[model samples]
Target: MKLPPWFRRRRVGVAATLVSVAALTAVMAPLQDDIGLLNEGLLLLLLTLVISGTWGREVGIFAAVTSNLALNFFFVEPLHTLTVQSPENVLALFVFLGVSIIGSSLLAAARASAEEARRREAETQVLLSLSRAMIGQTEPAEALASLCREVVAAFDAPGASVLTAAAGGWGVLAHAGSADAGRPADAQERTMAEQAASSGQITRIGHTGLGNSRRPRIVAPSGTQRIREADVGSAFVPLLFGDRTLGVLRLDGPIGATPFAQHPDSLLAAFAGEAALGVQRAELAQAASHADALRQADEMKTALMTSISHDLKTPLAGIKTAVSSLIDTSVEWSDEDREAFLATIDSQADRLNRVISDILDLNRIESGVIAPARRSVHVASLLDDVRERTALVTKPRVVTLDAGADIYAQADETLMAQALVNLIENAAKYSAAGAPIHLAASAAGASVEIVVSDEGPGIAARDLPHVFERFYRAQEGSRRVKGSGLGLAIVKGFVTLSGGSVRVESAPSGTRFVIQLPVAEQAKASA
Candidate 1:
């Protein structure tokens, strides 16, 4: 981080003062300047080394040898002579000189390495926080905005920029700092951003004469260069997902820094991966949102159709009954022929009624006119209840229950049972007679799961995601089923509202529909 210029000066001044004092003391200290008394000056040099090494290695070395010379010249018995006056002084002086030189340099290097490590650690933490914040963000604009602001705060930079590819060119989706950072991008910069987006290469430049092949053509404010050589010692890190360049993270160094330390790129690479994930998540969320809206509209259309069927079927049933009565004409018609005509009319009218009822119930649940009332319900009991209701169809299918009989969850008993019925009926309607449907339940940490597995040609992979969507019939649009396609949607709504979730897993072997509902807490008052 860049501090105010005054603060930096204060720090430098303090260090220099300490170094100067250490040097002065080493030179002036009293030393018996004789060949045998060389130890005194050498000891002074060692003191200077430990205290002054980090300030400057050269200063430490200079102070040590210079003090020895001063001691020999002034304190030696033969005054003003170059001789140490004792051979011992010569050996001690040589040892002190070597120690000062090697010790200070090593010490300085170690200190620099430690400080650098600390800076790198801090930067990593900031980048990690940014990545975490961006997760689960599905909107590109919001994701970009978050990325820009985070990097700005992390690096303490003057500004930050996020450039993304767009129609026919590049675009600045978000920015933080000066130059109307968040406003529309300049035309030329937008073009360059697009190119960088395509190449997926980092483009860094200072506010000097240099730029990458496709330079930043935008101008800065008057009197201050648009790309100031110092502040704009720029870095352009491309956000990539394999061959695709999702965006670019552009940062300007702190104001007045002379070539800031080169920030590591591995951390930057990790950040890019996180950003790409954010973009992907945002896109998925957006698509899901649209799909939801369309699904509601489709459900409404199905309800309209169901209502029409009901309105049309009621009168048709009366007409068919009257026609059957007239065909008999007080026992004039053949019994077999009359029976066949009446059966056909009854079957078709029943189909119409089922469709209408399904539509009405779906609309009620989904539109919130009738909300599911959730309570602690036993899973096995719910299944048995549905089985009884669906017995007429399940008798031939040999429906079986294989699950924890004691399992329970907080859910609407009626709605949950209805969901089970739909699943069983769905199996019966699609699968051949005598093909069994298996109902199972188990506890998994926070949730109690119920799975309904059936031996039927499972849903296709492409269609799996759309199964819960309304009117998403695997059958073609024009085909008719005695259903409104609203049951699964209602099931989903009820399950979700009750703090539960559902997923459809299928394979060539069969289809397994899983429902995960939160377990009811055992408490004295809250339960």
Candidate 2:
């Protein structure tokens, strides 16, 4: 609880000094003769210094005058009288009074200086805390709310709030304490806040016993620059960055409580500056994030257009040419020639279908719409299915499967087959015409490893890590590897959807793609 201002005034100090002096004289009067007049004056001077240190300068001065009179009466040659008989005693009395007054003033000034240092230290700590909060929180609303709480706690105010200028008018960005505490209690208080924001100055209002005054009363103290003081209550600090005024910080203290008044005006303004900087930084970060998203979207569109113009059109051109050859009337085509043309049409159509499927599958995977239905899948059967589906493409290249009969995995059979087909086809496209593709499956502790390896020229080390990225090509331009580049990305997505992981190892001799799936029995045991 805060004491009334009168309780803290000089009257209380004067009464305390009187009581203290009376007590000292009662104890020291008997020893005055043995201690001598000089000793008595020293003891009285000590008493005056103690009173001054405890009750401040005004009370100390009063104590000094009272002590001088008491020493002349109770301990000087003319005991119990205000008159000092000897010239030496008169000199001693004057010296004692002068020293006590001077000592009290020095002691009081020292105490005030120490108090001001402590207050400044506290203000620095609050500013440091605000800086940390601003840097730590990325969201503007959350950071401002945290700062409001800190302000309310630091000042012991009823509440605090931050208001930002909005389209139509001011909007409360964040507030702490009671719902009504930080908010303007009336139009007059709101106008004061707006005045501070518009003028780029600190505005304070103190409540009189009758009510708040109609106009704000301003005062400047000796030690501070442009420090404004009122009776005691609310303060409105503007948040200014450069020439722009971002918002206002409203501090609401109770009437007769000098929470905001206890700190210097410069410290409050520093807090406002910190809040403005946080607002500007948050806005910049948000703008950067938005720009990044737009750039990614543009890149995706460009890559998709590139793929359509090359991979899709290549097969389409072959199909159209083969159809035109089969229907040509001028030439007498042989039975074998007709059959070859039909085969070309079929192969090109299959290739076109694969490219479209990869595009759609990639879209689904990226959209998080694909959910795998995992179950026990026989390793040998899965490989056999993949081999049959990819036979048309992997024609001249040989595919050899190596797997144990007992090996089984927990996976979605359809997704697993599709992923394997992509890998096998990818290997066939890159390897030598007659090169052998190896498919191997083995039990490795609680998991099963399925590896599709090719004896083709290994991928460049720079391209190895990005092999699973959609639309990435190791070689750019006309000489680049064929296909949409979505095959390996689909392989990784499908495997991961089935609760499995895929990785690759490449060297000068060859490239190997490994997929690890949980063993059927092990998955069941854990579940």
> How do the predictions measure up, each by TM-score?
0.43, 0.60
Say which candidate scores most in TM-score. 2
Please write out the lDDT profile of model 1 over residues 1-527, one tens digit for every residue: 44443433435534654555455545554434343345555555566565444444555555556655655665544557778767776776577667766776777677657656876777768777886767766577677668777766665567777666655545666777777554455553453355456556555555422222343333343354354345345556677877877777666654332222333455556656766665566557768889999998888678666646655676577657757675666767677866766776776667667666776776676677766687787777787788889998777778888767667788877778878888778777656577888888887777899998888777778878988876666654223334556667767876776668888998867889899998765441145
Number of backbone collisions per candidate, in order? 6, 0
Least accurate 10 contiguous residues by lDDT in model 1:
208-217
lDDT for each candidate structure: 0.65, 0.79
Indicate the worst ten consecutive residues by lDDT in candidate 2. Answer: 207-216
> Looking at candidate 1, what is the lDDT of residue 524?
17
lDDT of 2 at 294: 99
lDDT tens digits, residue span 222-257, model 2: 344554344545767789988988888877765223
At residue 291, what lDDT does model 1 achieve?
A: 100
lDDT of 1: 0.65
Residue pair clashes in candidate 2? none
Residue 317's lDDT in candidate 1: 75
